[model samples]
Target: MPRLPPVDRLDLDDLVHRYAVLVDQRAFTAVGELFTPDAELVLPDPPTSLRPTVEVRGRDAVIGALGRLTGFAATFHAVVGRVADADPGDPDRATGRVACEAHHVSVDEDGRARDLTWYLHYDDAYARIDDRWLIARRALSVDVIATGPVRKVRADG
Candidate 1:
């Protein structure tokens, strides 16, 4: 397969980065704009505390599922690396893998807080629609989960 053009590669990278920023900001509404109308998002199942074996289909469903992130007091997603390649036979299609470190902070009723971090990667499929690249499918796989207590520091202090 021929490599994706420099511009296409950059656009794909921007798409992935945008997802991280939107999620961190809890801007679920804007996040939907990054996906195609029929996009799908698959999430892992298991020993992790996250919802298990979930598949969210379509743009609206994806946004709705992401809304669940509100359960966390705060969330941060950092994209560490990404690789994207154009389809061998079709320039309009592509695939990518993005590695990320995601942190979810939760506060207990007693005022204690904990941070649960997931070291994960997203396997993605992309499609060009009307000259713009959008995520068609994304599957998240968690490589590891680290949990620890956290102390909140006030900035004003």
Candidate 2:
């Protein structure tokens, strides 16, 4: 298959980066716009967390699932890298692997805060619809987790 067009490649890259930005901003509702109506998101069960593997289907469900991040005081997701290509027989379809580092901050009952970081990657399938690129399916795989106390510093505006 021919390489993905430069414009499509950039668009896919921007699409993934938008996910990181929206997630970090806790804009779960707006994030739904980046996905297809029937998109799916699959999350692995982390070794340190008791949560089972989670599979959410549909844009609404994906939004609801992302809202769980609100349990943390804050989260920062950095998109480290990504590689994507057009499907062999379909220019409107593509697949990619995106690496990310997600940091979650949580304050305990006594007011001490800690950071839990997950080094992970997403295997994504994308589809172009109505001249826009949207994630059709994404499966997250966590490679490592690190937890430590954090001394947060803030400045008043």
Candidate 3:
């Protein structure tokens, strides 16, 4: 297997880290900058949740979906590890696996509060565009999730 240039590897690694930073900062719009115009994102549905798998295509949709995180009172994303390989046939392309943990805090309309954390793994494909590394495709799988240190509401009126 041909090795990727050190600079390319560094740039791609930085790209992965920046996604977490941007999400944690709620700089969702900025997240779009890390992807190609036609990038794709596939997210698995949570266990026992009614929602179907999420598939977002194109940078604009990605930005819109991420921007909705503004509803959360707080969020933090940590990318813990990654393994990447550059394509020998296409030096400008690479693939990797990333592990992450994300915590979210939010309140429902009924005034109940919850804190949730998800352990996730990501499969990613990166491409160089205009000399910048960008995400071309990404699929996230949820390995585990813990929810609710629930703030229960007492019945009284």
| Per-structure clash totals for the candidates | 0, 0, 0
- Which lDDT value does model 3 have at 47? 72
Q: Candidate 3: minimum summed lDDT over ten consecutive residues — where?
A: 148-157
lDDT of 3 by residue, 83-121 (tens): 788898898899988899887778788777687888888
Per-model CA lDDT versus the true structure: 0.89, 0.88, 0.82
Q: What are the per-residue Cα lDDT tens digits for candidate 2 across 6-97?
A: 99999999999999999988889889999999999988766754232689999999999899898888888999989998899888999999
Please give the lDDT score at residue 63 for candidate 3: 90
Q: Best candidate per TM-score, number?
A: 2
Q: What local lDDT score does residue 147 receive in model 3, on the 0 to 100 scale?
A: 92
lDDT of 3 at 51: 30
Ranking by lDDT: 1, 2, 3
Q: What is the lDDT of residue 27 in candidate 1?
A: 88
After superposition, the stretches of candidate 2 with alpha carbons farther than 4 Å from their true spots are 48-52, 153-157
